[model samples]
Target: MTETLASTSSPTATSGGTPPPEAAWINAYERLSPRWQSSALSPQSVIPIAISRVNQVDAGRLDIEMSAMLKEQMVKVFSVMKPGLLFQYEAELDAFLEFLIWRFSIWVDKPTPGNALMNLRYRDERATDMRGKIRTGLEGPGLTVYQKILYCIATVGGQYIWTRLQSFSAFRQWGDSEQRTLARRAWLIVQRIEGLYKAASFTNLLVFLFTGRYRNLIERALRARLVYGSPHMNRAVSFEYMNRQLVWNEFSEMLLLLLPLLNSSTMKNFLSPFSKDKASGSSGDETLCPICQTNPTTVYLALPCQHRYCYYCLRTRCAATPSFRCSRCSEPVVAMQRHGGSVP
Candidate 1:
């Protein structure tokens, strides 16, 4: 599991990688009253296709655009949903599947034309018909038996492929024939391991559903990061709203990194969150620290009056004052927290 997470770490660059299949997974998730077709392609493309789909939701005539979109999405849904055919996080899975195909293609079965051993393509009539069904599948029932079988194969094969055994030096050391034999043996062993892992995964999912935990725990302990967003989070929604949270994390990190250079006086002013009681000042304005009696260079903490103090000054005076009260207001300082940016 640790290795699987490590091997599947997405490249920071988003330029080249394909997105995950969400619509298909969603359709698969809720068979009843589904809003959209299960796409066979990249989820990124689904947005445009889905928009067009909404535009033509009235079962309009299959014009060129309609037909093209349907066929394209069907192809994507078909190609993407296949066993061990993933373009992301499936490098190991695909590599291992390649070895399996290599072993199968040997001993009377020749490797297919225009195909690599590590990756196999199946284009039999059944495969074609199944894809066709997916395109028009909603008009009838959900995925057929053949489709279910494919998903089952895909699941098991995906779990096995998650092992990333192909990258192992020992596996590469084996000669072609030896590797084929080993593939068969490894296939059997993986079945047992897959069952165990699947059960563990199901249990973890159950725990996560109940407790809202697991990913964060794994991220902390094993650094096993998520390739996609959290399941509990809203999918098909804008993440721009999280820009604040992102900025906060970055701010916190910067604050920590700069902490060593900041002393009590400097730190106090920088994080000065409190303010003054405006009524106390005849001018109702404060421009300098009352303790220092100088203009503010950074954030000057304000007392409950016209008098201002650097965060350290007021906090120091407040502490020495009776019952830790503010100097200007003389109000009981129940609590104070940091606030404000540099005031220049």
Candidate 2:
């Protein structure tokens, strides 16, 4: 009975002989036992994708600002040369900066400054196989050398070429060429192409909203998708400064809305008593106008206060407000007099 039980559990006994070399042996208990299985990683939500786009926009803005600063420095260096000369090469300067960014970032399989901030990197979707263990749902193969080169050509070179073409066509007035002429036909073709591109972009945007992949047409064409670089890393952006800025912006807007309605003269009169110079009982400067705070070209004196002021400044104030008071002494100015003459 003991021998029969042992034989029944063995693979050789089941086959009536030794198992074939190709067949693998498994313990009965191991075969019957439940194995641990890992759940598949979930697809990324839309929020991170949107944040990545925002980061990209910010990176572009930073690039533009840097370009402007570089241009300013270059202009300073060539200040003695003809003015507006550097403006002619502005487009070239921008293209050069963009090329440097692409050369270092995409070519090296490194995340862009924007993508790096969000812990995201581009992955070649065509080469990625979904069957393997994917820890963050972002695991995939990095862009190949060919893909990187093509990306640079498509993004940087393509944009520069298109821009130049458009500018040249506009400058040459291709649209205003003789009817049915080649130039006119070319212009119409360009317009149609632009419209088609815009329509395609709109469709792509809707699809992206539904699926949360491929933020731009270039990305969609290349199959280079942004994915998280680190499974454990969180977003690096902080909203504290943004919150403060929003609060200040709201406060400034409110002030702007309310300020125009308030009486400027009343507000000035109300705040005048708190003035340090007024409290000290000293007319601040004899040569400088009390209202304008500059050396008066034609000095005049307020009737009761005798504070010196510019002729136009005092005349406009008295004309606008019949009850115009001395800015320094807070006394009613009934009339004005030239600095060396009697009251006029």
Candidate 3:
């Protein structure tokens, strides 16, 4: 994979569009009544169930009941999820992993839900807030890097709201505009992390590590992104599949691995292709990918003669050659295929 100089820059604001100031988020938090904020910030606000522990040696046991907020509302919000999974120490983490397994299984076994986050509302009535629409505006046919970053955040949040909330509550509770901005930051963080992990230069790590057991499912999850450079997709659900538990499990596992990556700055680098001007349709002639025609695939020059080919096509053709031969000159095929293929 190509290494772009790493920078700790803040995620770009929507081009031609300004971001709401930080105070806007603070203001949103302020919008919540004092009582709500007081409660929300408290550990009890979200967890209503009572927690009890006993010291075996002392034989002194303490039981504390959860606040009404948890019993009446918060827990209900998450009731669809298994109990003892939210914050059950090690057990909780394991539960989370199991949740992922269930989620992925759903994607693999059934028809994935269409418009996963279509219901999400945007603060500005004129502005589209549905994840798909916002995503299109940001990473659609002619999106910019800024746009792709924006969309990645939106799309990630839309699909993985629960997991993200578990890891970053501040983001979950953010106001509409604030959520967008924070989501951008989260995406950058993940990108950087993924890059760091990838720097080791293992081409098959994603495949080798994640492919077995969930092989078909993994491919389905990654296929559109790898092939079309689009990350906003409604998962495919198989017909007659009602195994929700299995589906949720797979999704849960996928998120545990995916959430951290999206939160890393290095991991954000992988999003380059999605934001490249080619996808945005801004490059005119320079932008279309020859192989797919829908997006601009990265191009590379062959050795000696410097003939160019779409990175995807070049790989297949070059692999059969001995010295990485130039298609035009039919020279030797010697160029080594890099990890993660080439980015457009």
Candidate 4:
């Protein structure tokens, strides 16, 4: 039995007694199984996933800005028309902008501006077959003409129709109609549909977190997946500048919070000795009150310190605090004297 097994294995083995390289490789690949092969071609890491989300947000923001600009220009052209007349067509304007984006981007087989910047493009998962070796794991066929049309209909047309329907329903007070009425029933159905859509979107989000495939309901329903556009390119977006901007914003916010609690006079007195111009002494402009930084109409002098101040300003400060000090010289003010005469 051992001699018969050796003769059978000899045909597959090489001269050195090891099995041929090609045969060994084929056997190893076969051992992977279909399940393992699918797992091997799983979605990308967190970076790409996060970038895809950022791209979606960016695209939405771009659409909003473009719509705003177009609306502003239209408003200028129709300036003579009744104010807020164009506001009635805001939904139409938004739909037009969305259509323009779809026509230029998805319709032309090119990625949206945001997706292009992030080096990502949408791929039709329905038509893609994961049989061959995927070099960068991003290799897939672009969306077909049918998929693109459906995407546009689902996103642009669907949104416009839903918005107009809601507005019309609300305008006609359908929800307030008799409970048994058709209008009331239609309103309830719309609300239920909206609720179902929201619930489905939440569930899709959970699935996306684990699979890193579809980021939104539209993509999942359309079978369109975002993938890397360039196989050789690295991540296009950089967080370094954003990190620095956040740091600066936090620092500024901290300063804003702490600034109100600080005493400007105390800080000036504390840092006065270190000032380079300290030895220069007070300037010749004695008419100006150091506290208010204005020329006082009725100048009053602080006793011992002899620094000038507005009468009301000095009186208010002295009354507010018994141990009021000179704002300029930082000396305790024992009495107030008029600029030209003594006052008790």
Candidate 5:
């Protein structure tokens, strides 16, 4: 939820331990070429396949993290509004979502094999003319039909896909209208999510292949020494979770942003201690709810306080009091959200 503003300055050489991707890849090829020399498949034939798989793996990891993050965000945002329903639908999508994530990722990444562009090998090594300068753009006769198709999609086509389908406005209105069935809407959202990830993965791979880095354009410009004559812009972003202290102005701004979600009735219900239905079939340990001194099946978490008690038990105490404070820390409970449940 928190984003740090990168300094707007000329990008200096990164001081990280990892070498540039170009360097790492060249080193890999050098180490592998000797062992592959006598094999039926040359490094050219084999390394592409190997590297393609590796790229696919990287794509998969990126997709998974994004999926989990998006899911959690969507769940949190909508949870209070439709308690049991959102989670139920989300549960059904889990298997299908995983499949879709993999399906599109593999398809998008399949073209990485022999992709000299992806490996940042813009120059053709075979060219003896031009003093070893590699050809830029399409490699003419050397590039195959499949490779061309992949390259077009990976670079040129993917951007359009992202702009057309994965824009924030498009995603904000994710799924179908009320006229459409939930199933249909879910499928549509899946397709969007699929396209989004594919476009994202391809774009990221393209960037990494080209630049070997993860910071976005905003990050790059900030890290640059000059943004059109201005010195580096100091990032106004805060890492709230990093225990960074905030001035009164920043703290007030955070509170303003957080106010909407907290003051709503839906949020209150979502954060409330469990009612009878919550504990009815749910099972729990023999240890009594800390507040109630009864073995409560339904648990409530007072976050930031971390002391969990029976939902009913905590709600009773908090509701009875005016402060609505966490029983342990006595932090005023301005915000609270539930984190767990299994849909049947």
Candidate 6:
């Protein structure tokens, strides 16, 4: 797994090289979400800062400025990320990145609060969809690395691409071999993510893949880092609103890269195999998994959270210990059970 946490070694930028824009953004994300930072912040804050900072500069004029800014920010974000967690949750990191791109794209064009908020919701849905696509065998390949990166960035701001993927399905509708081949390649990216973060536990997987409408909060916090400002508002939304939580400190940049992969419906469908009730509840008669439908009879029912998982799926997850905790809710699971167990 790639390192999730940033390097402790400070960033050393070669001034001559065309520095990656994300590098600076990553650093800013870290400084704002720092473990030692006195204030606690939600990821939702990343937006307001971006909007306000670049508000004065048009996209064309701000290109160079944003590039420099991103390099500065990335160094900070990567420095604090945990390498082991990155290795363990590499797939998740990528998925998060894919989600970010989808939403970021939308926000770049329309940075309104409503648009920004919608993008975060779109991120969760997109991530959930990508999980599913991986399982159902419909994701298309043929996208170049640049295309993947652009897709991820675009989706970061919640640029909707579900229609695009579904449109591609026209080929599958007619049984086109070439189309299916492309879908398979797209599906592979999500599969790779699941394998990387498999040990993250069902709840963690859910929150990591879905939930957390706090992108705006992160944007705000990040904005503060750039201007050395403080948070000025509350970003909490009630459960009725379907709020989801995503970890930022150790996983922001990796999350940035995965944004495109999560944008796919196939990826969301594959992840749906894990559980429903996001918070807690019964799986009921649903044979297909809530996140990814492929795995039936999820042998492992994570206690407390009640998320179910197929035995092989659970076994494939890597961890140093047999006992694991739900990544979504942070509840502990003593052992895998055939049936769902009560929270204790």
Which prediction has more favorable lDDT, 1 or 2? 2
Candidate 3 per-residue lDDT, tens place, 1-344, comes to 01111121124543444665676456555655675656646544332211111111011111012122223454556668888765444333333433443344222332112212221111111233333323322232222344334433433333355454545544464433445786767666665765864654254444434432111222233222111122454223243455777798899999998897663433444554576553554435333433345342555644444444567777776565444544333456456332245422
Over 167-235, each residue of candidate 5 has an lDDT whose tens digit, in order, gives: 543556654465347655755876878888678767765775565443233213222101111122222
Worst-scoring 10-residue span by lDDT in model 2: 38-47
Give candidate 6 misplaced runs (Cα > 4 Å). 1-111, 114-152, 156-162, 171-344
Query: Which candidate gets the maximum lDDT versus the true structure?
Result: 4
C-alpha lDDT values of all predictions:
0.42, 0.74, 0.39, 0.78, 0.45, 0.41
Task: Report the number of the highest-TM-score candidate.
Answer: 4
Best-to-worst ranking by TM-score? 4, 2, 1, 5, 6, 3
Residues 72-118, model 2: lDDT tens digits: 77668878978888777767766776788787888888877667766
What 10-residue stretch in candidate 4 is worst by lDDT? 44-53
Candidate 1 global lDDT? 0.42
Q: For candidate 6, lDDT tens digit of each residue in 1-344?
A: 01333342234433454544676557756765665343334343223222232221222233334434544564457767776554444334444544544346433432223323222112212222332223211122222344345544443333233334434445455334445665666656545655654544444434423432222323222221111112342222234433333444337778778886663445545676684744454455344343354556545675556666666655555255465555434456665666754332
| TM-score, predicted candidate 1 vs. hidden true structure | 0.22
Which scores higher on TM-score, 4 or 5?
Answer: 4
TM-scores for the candidates: 0.22, 0.62, 0.14, 0.68, 0.19, 0.17
Positional deviation of 326 in candidate 4, in angstroms?
Answer: 2.3
- Candidate 1 off by > 4 Å: 1-142, 157-241, 263-344
In model 2, what is the error at residue 260, expressed in angstroms?
2.3
**lDDT value, residue 329 of candidate 5:** 40
lDDT for predicted candidate 6 compared with the true structure:
0.41
**Candidate 3 — worst ten consecutive residues by lDDT sum?**
55-64
In model 2, how large is the Cα lDDT of residue 109?
86
Candidates' RMSD to native: 29.0, 8.4, 35.8, 7.2, 27.1, 32.6
CA lDDT, candidate 3, residue 64? 11
Q: What's model 2's overall lDDT?
A: 0.74
